[model samples]
Target: MALLERITGPRDLRDLTNDQLVTLAQEIRASLIANVSRTGGHLGPNLGAVELTIALHRVFDSPRDPLIFDTGHQSYVHKMLTGRQHRFDTLRKPGGLSGYPSRAESEHDWVESSHASSALSWAEGMAKGFALKGEPRTVVAIVGDGSLTGGMTWEALNNIAVEPDLRLVIVVNDNGRSYNPTIGGLATRLHGLGQQLSAIRTDRRYERALARIKRWVNRTPVVGEPAYDLMHGFKAGVKDVLAPQGMYSDLGIKYLGPIDGHDLKSLELAFEQAKQFDGGPVIVHAITQKGRGFAAAEQHEEDRFHAVGPIDQVTGEPLTTSSARTWTQAFGDELARIGATDDRVVAITAAMLHPTGLTRFAKHFPERTFDVGIAEQHAVASAAGLARAGLHPVVAIYATFLNRAFDQLLMDVALHGEGVTFVLDRAGITGPDGASHHGMWDLALLGLVPGLRLAVPRDEQRLQEALQACVRIDDGPSAIRFSKDPLPAALRPVRHEDGLDVLVEHGDPRVLVVGWGQFATMAVEVGNRLAQQGIGVRVVDPVWALPTPKALIAQAGAHDLVLTIEDGGLAGGLGSRLAQECRLAGVRADVREFGIPQRFIDHGTRAGILDDLCLTAQQLARLATETVLAGDPEPAPDQADQRG
Candidate 1:
């Protein structure tokens, strides 16, 4: 049997010899490449984490010890070792394994959050809890170097350093990239000659030998005390010269390593020593190469295949190609074009320059592009500062990640009345990446921000137009949100009514379908289908979706039944806002809201999730036809209560 197939749990790894462990690491890499290539996932991160993960399992008693992975994308190797290897083939699929670490999947996964930089906090908390309970469990936090760039990691470290009783081990898996290369002061501090010094000084054997020498010196005469003090001062001086890890040591936390992450024996030795240490919290820094064993991933410079879709495993080329432009590409091209004309235009990203489509703008205006390194709050506040300096800063980030910087957006940007344009990509129900990855909360969240204008564009033209409009608003902050879905062909409106674009109108329409963003196309389909069923239907797309446009409210007044469709949370989304506006305007049309429900929606294809929610054209048409024919609009079924 193959070594991978023979292993059912982490304990099986303990039986393997050094040569067998090397073979196991090789098998894991092959398994990762072969499986992730077919299913599509965080291949590079997992590839680099293979031996490190194996070593962790060998040293620590997981589930009891609690291994908390920062961001969880790099936990694939951990999952495989802990009996989920059988489900590797079903990764990110409907009713299958989740892309990130899932609590539902295994007890081995304690933290399921895919958001970066919070693992150290989780480890600290777990360590505290275990200490309070008098449980002799060491909490292990396996964090990436990219995650260390976030401010939260330091905050947790600051607290963890003082707690001398807590048994905690923080493993810094320094692959040197998050979504892009890790930036800012922390990454620089973790760089260079620290590796050589850590290997010599931080080794467990070296520590033991030093302790023996100190014991012998203390047993001697009065010179023994002075000699030991001199030795300590010399050691600190050497550390300052040779190790960049003085940053951690200065914070009063025990620092070890810059160990070779791929070397199983070395990783195990460091982890084992860290687990045995009684001193507060220890940081074992391991230097790893992203996409370690895979030549294809290692050589492909940009992010080292950080996250990939289905690809040719051997060539590292994408397997499927789409001729249709994505909303991201359209936005990137438009932003770059705008930057070419406007010297004042600048860009900012929370370490997601490529994914957010800011790469094109970055390439041309490299000086103006600021990658804030997994810190969204910093990005937003920094954009506000840029705007204050007379530069129009366009902050491009994923919609889901914007939740992290809400305070900055509301206070620093909106309150200051700064001309900061936030471009939210992946603004709707993103598939495969699961609940945490879905960008459903931004519409609801942004609506709550005072003086912040939000635009949800339906197509490429509207996206470009929205971007142009947002940048011109100098008095307050503005945002444009678009989905991860491919850009639909531009929907030409029959007539522009105020700010509304009427895409479909049947004679003397009784039912009006108000759509926002990508849902506009779905609304048009539903409208046409309803018209065929002998119901008069009008479909309108409000390019600027938030603030409940006056024209949309007036249009809603004329219809017998109005259906507002969005791709965000139903409670506080655009649909709810428009309905509230209609009530305040005394528009008596029965308004029904259709969007994501208050509960968390599970992972599936975007189309499949929509169908399950009865948000599809066929389902909506049937419901709308019934509501109009009956002449009394009842409440729409709660998506949370409905069967998938």
Candidate 2:
């Protein structure tokens, strides 16, 4: 039987002997490597976590004793063990199993999280909830060392340390790279100290010599008193050097292990000991290699195959050419261009150097670029500080990730009217990474911030212009949000008689199409299709999506049927804002809103999602034609033609 077939669940896993378990882990690694190569999911993190995951399920009872994984990308093996092996083939595809943990998928998955450093806080809350109810259950939070760089983890650590009766096990999976670990003085010192301690622990004479010195000091005369004190001081210094537990020890949490995470026997033993310790909070630091079994992923320099698309199974080569330059690249290119001209320009990112497209900026102007690792709150506050210090700071961040630091943006930047420019990439729906990674909420959430100016560009040209305009606005916090979609080769400037442009005008149309951002092109296509059916429609593009375009409201008043289309959620989005404006303006035109619903959209191609939600050209054309002839006395087509 295949290794995956032999194990149906965690219970079946317990029945395997030690050798079989080892064999099973190897088989799982092989399968993970093969599948990820073909389908292209998170490869290295999952590969590194195979043995640790096996050890976790073997030692702890999940579901009953909930196991929460921080940034759940490392939960692929856990998903396989929980009877999701069959759906592994369609990983990250539309209508398939999600890439991250889903509470809707199974009872075993308690919390679905893909954000880093959040598992500890969730574990703390769940542990506290259990304590309040007087319930007995183990709560384990498996967090990686990279996640520890986040300030929220430390905040949770401080709280977890003080909670006297909170039973929580924090498993720190240390792989020694957060994208790329800083090769600073602290990192070098820690590396050397770790090696020295390993050598000292192995030598039996070292321990014996220390015991002998202590005994000898007790035997000496007047020198004994001072010598004993010196010995005690030396021991304290040695403890500080060897242990390196100052941070956690002061926080009042018990720390265990810098153990070999791949050794199943050692891991099992350590877990057994941890279970017995009736302490407030315990941390087990396990050092494992990302892409542990697969040589190709192991050899990867940075991120260790953190995220990938489809590739060849044997060589690990990508199956296709790189797609067009993304919005991230555009933002970076624009920033670099601006930086060349402006001496006061600086860039900031929350641990995302490559993702935010600031790698080139950092290379050219190393002193001006700051990568505050996985700390969005700090990124915003620091940007605010930089802005206050007479420098123009452009904080580039993902729209979804920016939600983490909304308060800082509102209070530290916007409220104070700081000249911080926020270049938000992936502002709209980002498909395939699943709900947690979607940039849907930025507009709704950020729009609520007082005195903040928000701008969404329709194309690459507008994006460049918006970036320039936002930075020039030194009065307050201004942001420009753009999609992750490939920009058009060239965007024709919207020719405006007033402030709005009529992109596609069909005279005396019963319907009017209002398009926001890049969705304008889709509206034009829909209008063309509607014209073939003897239906007339007008398509208008609003370059400015916020502040309720007055030109758009007047245009809506002229049509019998008005439809607003956007890529964001209908609730509190452009469509919602338009509807409110229409109501306030007392425009009685029959208005319809079309966009993503107020629910989490699943992983799929961007086009596939648009089609699924009936936002495609065909769907839009059909809806428009039907709405136009809804109340009219139009003759029906022949029964046979209608059926066809």
Candidate 3:
């Protein structure tokens, strides 16, 4: 059997010899490439952190010590050593291993939150818990250079610096990239350190100078030991001709190394020393390459293959490439076109330039584009500032990520009546990435924001129209949301009536079906199915789902039953809002809502998840049929208005 098969757990890794450990690292990388190629996951990050992870497991006792990965995307190798290697093929699939660290998967896995820059805070709390309970365990937080861009990391760092007795070890995995090259002041200083490390490695003069200083300090009597200790603390300064290494040291945290992360010996030594240090939290800076062993990932510049689909392992080419335009692509292309004519429009994203489809806009108008380093709150506030300055700002981000900036969106934008357009991509059931990745809460969450005009476009044409319309609104905040799914064929409305698109109509319609965004297609299909079953149905799409249209409410009063279908959460969704509107308007209509239940939907294909939620056309058709039959055909003369 190969070396990988011999190791079952982190404890087993301790038994392996140095040469065997190297072989084990090689085998693990091979396994990662092979399995991830088939399953498709966070390939580059896992490959880069192979040696670092091995060293960490060997140094720290997990489940007791609690190794917390910052964003958890880089925890695949950690998963392998924790007895999950056997089931690695099921990564990111329906009923298999999660791409990130899952607490349900093992006791070794502590915090599973994939949100960036929160590992330090989790580690601090755990360290405090261990200290208070008299437990002799160290808390390990393995955070990336990418995570450092988030402000929460600094908040935790500031708190951890003051706690002198906290047993915490923070390993900084500096690969110099988070999706793209890490920007901002900290990354620049770290980049300088990388350059300094290279100079120190090549030049013998620097090493000799350090040796002479150590000797001189040792030669002196009484205060020699204390002097040497002080001098040793300032050693990083001796080589600081390139970059000052006082970022962590300035915070009063014990800083160790600009060590080679790929080197197992260096990583193990740093981790071992960090584990032993109880003098507050120790920061072990390990500089590794993002796409270390993978040539394809290393060469391909954009995001270094951060997240990949199924690909040819050798060539690093996608196994199957679709020419079909995605919702993101459509939105991006339209935004870029809009930017050409509308010079007042500026774009902002929280470190997601390519993913959110803002790349084209950034390329065309570089000055107007701002990549706000994984800080959603900063992005929203900055966009608000931009809007205040008389410029229309388009803030694009994933629907789920916007949850963090809700306060900023409410206070800075909505409160001030800023004309900021927030284009939320992946605003529906995003499959495989699991619960935290789903953009299911936006419709409900945005409903609470007063004066926030929200649009849920049905197709590519509607998406373009919505974007144009949202950008034109200069009074209050406007938002347009679209899914991660492939862009469906354009569906023209049979008639446009009072801001609602009537997609399908039946003679003497008794049932009025309302669909929002992508579900509009499914609603039409449901209507067709009902039509064949001898049920007169009229399906309509509320182009803008928020603030339930007056026409829709009037239409509902005409029909006996009103069924609303949406992809968002059932609570406070478009469906729920329409029902509430009907009640408030004194329209005597039996309103039924169909949407995703207010719960965490797990990892699966979008189709599978939708089916599981009973949001499919066939399932909905059967339910609608039952509902219509169960209800009264005619309303009382004193209640419902029969005028159509």
Candidate 4:
């Protein structure tokens, strides 16, 4: 039978022997390797979780008992077993299976989370809800060891520990990485502690010494019975001291196993034991290797093939050649240049050095680059501290992840008027990863910050100029958000002026097209198309989206119709700000907003999503022409009324 064809669901795997379970795991791995190689999704993390996932499904009744995956990148195995196998071939493609878990995708999936450390909180809430209704259902939160570094996980742990009857099981899948693991004093200490714990488990000499101490204590006079009584206490104390028990055991949650996650027999046993436990939150610490079966993934130094675009299965090489430079690479190149010229230039990231394009800066100036692991709050506050010390700290982070540090950004950085630069990658509707990963809310959230300067670049030249402009400012915090799209050909000669640039002009009754970031190219294209239809439209690029470009505002007031387009959300975004400005200026021209809706968009190709949102050139042309024509008033109805 075909590896994928052998099993219909989790029920089919229940009767399989241990040997057969192992074979099933291998088959799953083979299927994943083949499918992901073609489609290019998360590879290493899925490979590591094959047996653990199988064991999880076997022990628990999913859909009835929800299995929540943190970050959802490693849910490939879960998806396969949940009747999504046929659609697996279209994984991460436009209008196909999402890379992350979606509640809409299956009954088995509960919460669809791409942000790290949120699963525990979601599980806690669900478990609490279950308890309130007297619903008897198990809630399992599978969190990667990498996710442990996030501050919210600790917050969730603190909350979950207090609820002794919540019936929550936290499976810690420790593969020892959150992207590329950092080597610091804390890492070294954790390593030493792990080694000591391993020695106590395996070395006979240490075991014999412990045994001798136990025997000598039992052989004592009046202390014999008392000593014997304390032996169990001593063992428990030692276990608590040496292992991860100190972290959660003190909080009243049961700590079980640093088990072999790859071994199906051991994993099944652990799952069964955990299910039997009746009180509090329980953490089953499972140790597994990332990219367990694949040689190339195992050997990968960074991220263990976390996300690949398209690749050759046999040789593990990228299938397509990348001619256009990615936004990340552009940021990296610009930061590198900035660092080399300025001695005070420094960079910071919240455990996303490579993803945020700080890897090049780390290589160029290792001492200046700081990787504060999975702690966005700390990263932002630390950047404020760095700025206080007279260093220009550029904190590079994804726009979505920066949501974690909004409070810090507002209070610590913006309020204090710190000269910290924030470079946000994936600033708009990022596709395939789904709604949680989309960088849609940054503009609205950051607009609330008091003295923060905001910049949105349309192309490579503007991106470079924006970065330069941000670093040179000494007054307050500044953020520059850019998309994943390649630099457009039309924006090649576009220089970053202090304010907006008028790209096109036609006639006295002008229609101003206010463009922000990469969407400027779209505006220009729309303008040209409308021009063909005999509608005069002027295109303007505002390098600065925030501070409400005064010059641009004046120019917009001169036009008969004003259209503001951005990649971010329309609520309290560039469009909202521009409309407010127009209202304040006593301009009666029809001000229209063009951006993403308030609701979350689903997973699809970027272009497809844009088209669906009516953000394409054709859609813009139609809307603009209609608006302009509708605004044109009745010419001579007043003549008959005046005569009467």
lDDT of 2 by residue, 1-644 (tens): 88777777888888888889889998898888777777778888888888898988898888888989887888999999998887888888888878889888888898887888989999999999998998887799999736877889888888898896788888878776642343222333464454345344334475478679878888898798798888777755765565554466567676665557788876776666566566567776667788788776777777777777787766667888767877788888988888888878899997788988898888889899998888999999999999889889999988888889999999999888899988887766788888877788877776677767767777778788888887887768888877788875553633674566677766577788877777877877887787788777787777777677888887788888787777776667776677678889997666677777667778887788777677777877776677576753222221111110
Q: Which pairs of residues collide in model 4?
A: 164-280
Residue ranges of candidate 2 with Cα displaced over 4 Å: 178-237, 489-494, 585-590, 632-644
Worst 10 residues of 1 by lDDT: 179-188
Better of 1 and 3 by TM-score: 1
Per-residue lDDT of candidate 1, residues 449-567 (tens digit): 88888888998888889988887899888999888988888899989989999999987898999889889999999999998988888999988877778999999889888888888
Go through the candidates in order and give each one's C-alpha lDDT. 0.85, 0.77, 0.84, 0.80
The 10 consecutive residues of candidate 3 with the worst lDDT sum are 635-644
Output the lDDT of residue 121, model 2.
95
Task: Report the Cα RMSD per candidate.
Answer: 3.7, 5.9, 6.2, 6.6
Put down candidate 4 lDDT per residue, 360-460, tens digits, no spaces. 88998999999988899999999999999999999999998888999999999988999999999998998877787789999999889887889898878
Worst 10 residues of 2 by lDDT: 635-644
Q: What clash count goes with each model?
A: 0, 0, 0, 1
Model 2: lDDT to the true structure: 0.77
Which pairs clash in model 2? none
Model 3: per-residue Cα lDDT over 1-644, one tens digit each: 99888778889999889999999999998999899999888888888899999999999998788999987899999999999999998999899999888888999999996989899999999999989999999999999848888989889999998898899998888777742343323444465465445334334465478689888888899988899998776665654544334677677776666677788887887777677664567787777777778899999877777889999989899999899999999999999999999999999998899999988999999999999897898899999999999999999999999898999999999999999999998888999999998999998889999988988998999999899999999988999998999988888899999988999998789899998898899999999999998899999998987777899999988997787888787788887787788889898777777877778878989999887777788877877787677654333221122111
Which clashing pairs does model 1 show? none
Scored by TM-score, the top model is: 1
